[model samples]
Target: MKRNYMYIVLAYGLFLGWLLSFPYNGPVLKHLVLIHQVPIASFSLVYTVVPAVFLIIYLLFFQIKEEYAKNIMNWSITACIVGTVILFTLPTYYWYPVLAVMGIGSVMYIIGWSYYYTMEIPIDEKMRIMALVIIIGNSIYYVINILHDQISIGFLLAVIIVPLIGAFRATSNIAVNNKIAVELEHEPLPVKLIFVICSFLFAVNITDGLTFHAIYPSFDQLFVEYFTFYGIMPYIITLVIIFFFGTKLSIMFPVFLGTSVLGLAYLSFGLMGKNWYSYFITETFLQMGWALLDLVLWTLFGLIASIYGRPLKICGYAFLANLLAVFAGGLLAVRILNKLDNYFIISAAFAIGIIFISFLIVPWLSEAIEKDLRNKLFKTNLQNKPIEEISPLSIPLPQREILTPREREIAELLIQGFTNKQIADLLHISENTIKTHTRKIYSKLDVANKRELLQLSFSSRMSKGRSS
Candidate 1:
């Protein structure tokens, strides 16, 4: 709650702005290939290798820092600029690899910024913010694509430029973690959940890979049509569900159910059905299912990072896992594309198995996570209580300048690193009210972040004691 919600909104808005600024090739790749006389293989090579490079670099060297989010946002903007220049100016296929590498960089920034922003928010706001960002960001993406041919090159450039300027301001205002607040032990992993999640992701990724490649060859014309008609459908439905029924249901329910639908949809698509109506039905389910899965999966990843207090480690691993799953799926799909009967049979069985397993896995994982979080809280409370003979009550107070009683109370709790939600619970106030109090405290004290406030308060107290 120490964070301003407006900042969160702005940060996310900038991310979307940066994302949509990159020219979408899905609708134009064929034209670019045929008209520009560029080899299709170059594009294929780029699409294949970019993810590999991204995963390798991330695993080898990406580390979390205080300015991690801001830095990533900057990198994304840089990459977008580079990619835009190359795509518009260069017609040669030779530059495809270079553009691909830049694209990879932009994608990594997307993931990195998402991790950084989501971890700071309270769990209560995580789902809503995640949904809102996706819905809005993707809407911009689709709208840009829909107008791709109709708009002028200069106008497109302006679209890229305007949001970016605002994004820069928003990103700069974001807080950085100059120090590591918590150290996490990586041993004693949650074996069951990890196993299930990995297996499920692998299976789903394979189906997704197969479906896309298989469908695109026969239905290339439908890409833009599908995007036009149903691009925002899933996101809208997701927003409604989250807005209307978020409190009544656990996220695990939608996650499992959506995944199950996705599996079935993939199975249908793999069977080589020629009926246009069936394709429409399959795609409709695919969009909705994927929307829910994306929302829940990324939110879960961010939550894990927050809970473990190791944002980079958790998110990096998740990204790596996704990369591997997608890569393997693509390879398998390529191998089986000629054998439609076998592909259909195998994909259908995999889908059915995943759906059944999901029922058992999702509920168990949710319960385990809740139980573990409770245990951690209990242990933390015990550790916070001083065990020495001296009581906390005997300690001298910080000699700060005049503060409202409410502000003083908030400062003390903030010093203890209690989240906004925790403070709201303790004070029986709304989290929004807590945020307002925090903003006022920071303004009065001229501090930007919690660490600064704590330092200022303690230093003043120490100076007063020395003089006395």
Candidate 2:
């Protein structure tokens, strides 16, 4: 894929975040509810339930046809436009059904584009792409929230239409590659691991729902008072952390830490009683924790989809888990907690309790799952076999003197299946430097590619073992 094509993928990410931040989950929902005098409970239910049902249906039954994916995507965009228009102009009675149709369109839109992404992009590239997407997408969301007062219906329509145009152009330019499918057949889906992680996400996000309600009792407060400092800054910081350290750190570390931070944030809210100073401190931590967890959840799903080569299935189920948890927590907060006294205290206790449970379980799950994925991805099963049995004398090994120490190190990493980018990151060098060394290593070893280099290395090692 062209580098420019990867940049274009950002349009889809921006669109997703923009939609969620505005018309779906954020300010627009509040705007509509307040203006049309729709009950919050009924509005929340229709918004959450309709899309969630569509996501679940897609997860269970829908499959995107690769050939017709572009058409599906274009049509889904049209549905979204029509749905938005109807939503803005129509009577309250017509809202629920239109929302349902829009929800289906959203699901189709996501699944269709995601299928192309998973098929065309390699896993490593997917990680970089997703990280960039989250960073820029959320930044755009924050900017919109900041300027919400200035935002007109025309502005909203422009946001949708601009990205839609870009997305259509990008999808047209995407080059199809089926090489990943062959690898997918060899690797088994880590079904149990995925389920457990999804369950953890569901549980954690329920606390988010509770705390979200506890922190901002009114949506107007979210817009006018809180989101400016407490919301945008911490989230931006979190995105930066994910962008820089995400690949280097284990997923469990951030998750555990995020949950702990959130627990403490809520605990502070209960103990400190929403004083300005206290609110600032707690809400900053709260946004950081929430942003961290949300980004990690999507990153985890993207990683799974990359490995499994079924983007729709993996991402759809992930979306379902996350959406349901948020919905359930939101519903619980609205219906039950609003009636209860000391709701902040109740929410804090629940969040802190989940932290304890996560602390106990996340380590074991992370270790086991990471180990399995690493072993499978790196072909570490060869370690269990005899050297002679696994290594064939298909390629001649070059003399050790032909390579410099740096070249040797680079070659070793290549044989171990590290990409140039990974090797550069590991060695604290520029990728261009790594590329230079890789070229020298390839030339010295008389190999055109990593596969040949691997064959040569294996044969050399096996020969040495026999001689010794």
Candidate 3:
């Protein structure tokens, strides 16, 4: 970890130098879009294809046979790079017919790949549903890009491409690579609690890129459109930094998660669905927050190394917390957006408040999510034999799955001694609003009153060995 930190500090210093070296009006290294004269095939060979080859080579050379996960990692990056290219290369000068296939193929591949992300959830029939959704969403954006690429390639990428790829990397990487700790130490919760921080970094980085486009639409439209591929660089840097430097979950996780929630809440609810432009603007804020959030994550690492600890997990929570948060947030954001004619007013007010509350309280439900995971298939035969009705790996989250992102937050708040009024205040809604959200929290926690809620919270974590 220390080594990784050194790389980041050096990289950061060099990056700062480059930023300062540029003529303000001429070209900022951070924002400079690299253009290559090579053909798509040739450039992809160097960028996408070769990197894939390298990973294959590395894995083979090292005799690493974890094909499912490693392949997903390598190819997912390729999909994003190629997809970003196809998404951006329109109407400028380098539009290609193959881009259509590349775009579509990459989408399918990523969707297919995400299945292998976690040993807990491998590819199955369900993945088809996920793939179809991707196709539908991409088709809509594809049409939008065709219509407006000339005006602003960046906007489409920011709103569409970035999120999709971000989601892609998230689901796949976390599922496969991250560690699933059987329990937490209670004191300085490590991997489990680290999730909040990862989400913060992820949300902020994504939001940071989006912010540029929101404020400066034209430039962002082109530069960011192309740069979305490179946007992965910070995360890449983050991983490298983590690998060499060492980070602590207790320190980094909380701060990153807090920043991410606030920023993402601003993106989704801040504008309150005022318009497509609102989304554009809010997303821009989220993108900037992501980088700063990452810095916090790195700092968390610094603190950890100051002592002596290692992140027990990697892509698992680092990726999933962000994924699930976005999943839940997007679900809420869309519902509110569609249901409320005053979309902006309703969406912004509700999302921000809940987001804040969630930041304050999700660790409480760490138990429930884990409890459900542990006993999911456990049962005792009449005679006296233990049997698991289902493998935690195979059984999908039920239609009535436990703890949603919102409910989890509500649980946290409940434990924190947040009354309905306080929650309402934090969420920018009414007391009645708090009642409604609290009700959901109760259902998820399977308890009545604040007492049961707190009881369930502790019990759930204790089951998972997370006691703090």
Candidate 4:
């Protein structure tokens, strides 16, 4: 549509505007670290606190599904403006709180912007656009910082351009009035999936946070250069790699690959100390891998939103899980970073152990969840009927007599081994609605789960045969 094209233009303009307005994070961090003598641990406040605030906002306002997108955007803009003002003034009194608020605003804006694109744009196109945005943003930011020692020029441009970017119309994809009227509890987020995602995130982020805190401040200029180059080089290269190899593969393929790179980066830092190449590897490859993993994680959460029928809720939970782990990891790093004697060796060993656990837990957890769901479904069926023997002819008897026509249709699919998700898709309804109907079908048939319903159908057919 013309609307989508307009949005694509706006997205590009927004990134350009953002970069022009706020050059690079390097200068801000440098100002805080050098001028204010702010502890590296203090910077963790932003990552830790902002998502919690957003989570609260998500719970309070977004739950109603009324003007969700607009509200999020407004909050983000306000926060960013406030953050920038405080930073520009270079206030000494309330340093942490001011920076934290700014971080909140900026991060919220980013979250809202990302959510909009994911909802509105197709995946392949979205990936390319995002890559371009990063490449351009970082290139502009670093170029400006490298060219001029004074930050005044960037600030002046930002003052002129940010408002123009703000005035552009942003499209909202969330329906103002939700038709299904499903309650929050019916969202059907699997526990095992949450565990797997949260655990993996925690492991990766903890390693990064600890190593970053350990090594970053020691070589500040090198750290900034490394990330600047990382942003320019790897962003493009990874996108190209993914464009070719990533098309046919599962998102998890990149995730696993990223995890490997991340672990290696950690190991290199642990063993190699503060060498320039180590910095390059850590900043470029490790970050590239992180970006890949991050892309998939957000995309998966978007899929979860579609699957569950509560976009805001599912996204919020995913965000909360990710941010919570990141915050905890940062805090832990702050504590142990100073305490460890041979920090590199211990950290490398820790990362390896965690990665090993990740491999064991993720797949096993997935299988365990599937097996558990099946077992729960099978409990009501005391008699074992061969699954295939439950036939079309058997459909008219017992539970079929009790179920509504639509429920019967769903029951037939269940007997045919269609998953709830598959049934939802085929029926062109939300998965939550499918689950609601499934529960109703179970209740009507005096059955606990899918296996029992099929058994009743089969048993009814056997009884009919005996009577005949």
lDDT by residue (tens digit), candidate 3, 203-241: 433333223322234235445554333333433333333
Screening candidate 4 with a backbone cut-off below 3 angstroms (N, C-alpha, C), the clashing residue pairs are: none
lDDT of 2 by residue, 1-468 (tens): 476447446647656665655556666656666778877556556666888887776667776545576677778777777777777678888877777777667766766677666666554555445656667767776766666555776576565455555655665665555554444532566788789778988988887677666566533343446655456678678767776766676666778878888888878877887566666778777878877777666667766666555666676777678779988888789788878887877877887888888888788777865776675566534433443343212233558678887777777766766667667766779999998988888887788988888888888988977889
Model 4 poorest 10 in a row by lDDT? 176-185
lDDT of each: 0.63, 0.69, 0.39, 0.57
Model 4 reaches what TM-score against the true structure? 0.67
lDDT of 4 by residue, 113-220 (tens): 544554555444544444444444444444644533455645644543454354334423222222322321234656557556656666666655565566565456
| Model 2 C-alpha lDDT versus the unseen true structure | 0.69
TM-score, prediction 1: 0.70
Worst 10 residues of 1 by lDDT: 388-397
Against the true structure, what is each candidate's TM-score?
A: 0.70, 0.74, 0.30, 0.67
Top candidate (lDDT): 2
Misplaced by over 4 Å in model 1 are: 1-3, 9-25, 28-35, 39-41, 44-48, 60-62, 160-166, 176-199, 216-227, 267-272, 338-346, 379-468
How do these models rank on lDDT, best leading? 2, 1, 4, 3
Kindly report which residue pairs in candidate 2 clash with one another: none
418: Cα error in model 4, Å: 11
Model 1: per-residue lDDT, tens digit, 326-363? 56666666666545655556666767776777777788
